[model samples]
Target: MNPITLEGPRLTFRELREDDVDALFEIYGSEVATEHLSFDPRPLDSVASVIASGIADTQVDPRTVYALAVTLKEDPGLIGYARLALEAHRAGQIGFALNPSVWGQGYGTETVRLLLQLGFDQLGLHRIWGARSPKNAASARAMSGNGMVEEARIRDHVFTHGAWRDSITHVILEDEWRQPER
Candidate 1:
């Protein structure tokens, strides 16, 4: 798949680049930003690795990960990041994060919607799902608002933050995703 650029009402999603290191480091390393993450990333190499992975993704033919920088359309500055990890159950698994300061303002929801748009509409995928910490109601809401339905709650499925944490899996199939509500 070719590198993509998606536009939302309030943001732009594009391929990650090497120059995004500084902003990515700040967001990924922040305490507030890492609060919901499984682990706080150490800035020295993680950011570079993400960019490198994205670059590598662009070269492959069958497409793997769609790692994008979520930026303000007006400013073109990175505010967060999102990815579609393809090849999961013959579909895609969506994941995203944002600066804590920008939390609860609907950007997360829009970002997820963009991922769905790319996966189902653009990429011709059959199914896509999102897995999130059960405690994060906002994330659940985002998934639901974008036409995903709760499929399961796996108890103690992932070990995060020094303990096993439950996760909620939400999914939307291509046929259902075409509904006007999306």
Candidate 2:
């Protein structure tokens, strides 16, 4: 696949590079940002290792992952990341995290919309899904804002932070997404 760069009104999405390790580490290394995530806060070395592997994927498998860095368009500073993980079927699963500094500024909703557009419109995917910890109300609203419907509450779905956590999944079919009126 060609290198895909998605442009939103205020952000740009592209493959993360080795040089982005610092910014990525800043997001992942923070306890506040990573609290609801499956993985714990990572060290700088671990982040560098992951970035090295991700950047080596010359042929990106949309079925596996399209991990992208979410950066501000004007300043080009990395705020966080958004991922579209494709399932065995045609549906794709989306997720994102933002810098704690930018939490309530509508970036989350815009990020979801951009990923949905990339998955459904550019990738020709039929369905796109997202899941968030039941405790994450902000993520719930962001997914809903993008036309995703609550699908299920998967109890004990994932073991994180030494305990089983519940996850609520949301989905939007291609036919259900209403493109913005220009």
Candidate 3:
């Protein structure tokens, strides 16, 4: 598959590259970045290794995961990443992260919108879902802002920061997405 480049008002989404390791490290290393994520902050070496592994995995199985580098249109610097992992029966899971410095700037919403369009239109995915810690109000809001509806609340779904946390699961179906705006 060709590398996909999605442009929004302030940000762009493209394929991740080896050169993105440093920027990705910076984003993933931030405490805010790990706030709702499953992982914790770690050394740059470990972060680089993870990025390398993801790149290698994509090379091996293009349909397994489509990881995109989020960048600003003006500066064109790597801010973070958005990914969609294919699951069974034409369904998929969507996820994203951004540098805290760019938080509240609507980049997350734009990235997710583009990703959903690609998943439904290009990838022919029937259903796309996302989940986040219930405590992560920002992420929950971002998901809602991008047309994802809360499907369920998985109680005590994950353990993080030394405690079990509830997870808010959200999903957007292709037919729902095709509806015209009110």
Candidate 4:
């Protein structure tokens, strides 16, 4: 399988590595970073396991999961985690989280754009979608900014943070994606 590596104007998406545990921990282990994610902040050991699993997933034939590291163009340190899981009928589900320190920057939108590019341009997928917590306006904006339309609200979608929570799904078709110039 080809290793996934994508470059945008401000960021790069690369295959996750075992050594990325500590860097990824900066996002996965932070309450603020995992606030809108389905799960709570992960422990350091959990981060290691997550990275390990991601590395193993890449080696699977006909790979269906892309769990990548988001890094700046000039720096090769992991600043965020991005995932795209392929499903049947030419569709994929995407999710992402960034370090809290980089929250306000345009990285989230760029990450979404890169994921769309990967699904449509690279993977030959027809539809790509992502779900975000209803209250996560930042995630909503990021997906929308990348041409993903808000499609549905699934009630009781996930039981997180001690209660059932709804999720807002945003989707884009391969034809509908407006690819950015390289």
- Clash pairs (backbone) in predicted model 1: none
Location of the lowest summed lDDT over 10 successive residues in candidate 2: 54-63
lDDT of 3 by residue, 25-89 (tens): 88888787888886677679887886787677666645578878889987667897888889999
RMSD of 2: 2.0
lDDT of 1 at 72: 85
Evaluate model 3: give its lDDT: 0.83
lDDT of each: 0.84, 0.85, 0.83, 0.91
In order of listing, the candidates' clash counts read 0, 0, 0, 0
Regions more than 4 Å wrong, model 1 = 88-90
Per-residue C-alpha lDDT of model 1 across residues 1-182, encoded as one tens digit per residue: 47799999999998888888777887777877766666655575887887788779888877788899999889777788899988755699998888777888999999999999899878888999888887788889989998899999888877766788888899999989887764
- The alpha-carbon deviation from the true structure for residue 121 of candidate 4, after best TM-score superposition, in angstroms, is 0.3
lDDT of 3 at 3: 65
TM-score of each: 0.92, 0.92, 0.92, 0.96
Clashing pairs in 4: none
Better of 2 and 4 by lDDT: 4
Q: Pick the candidate with the highest lDDT.
A: 4
Q: What is candidate 4's lDDT per residue for 25-53, written digit by digit as tens?
A: 98888888888889888999999999999
Predicted candidate 4, C-alpha RMSD:
1.7
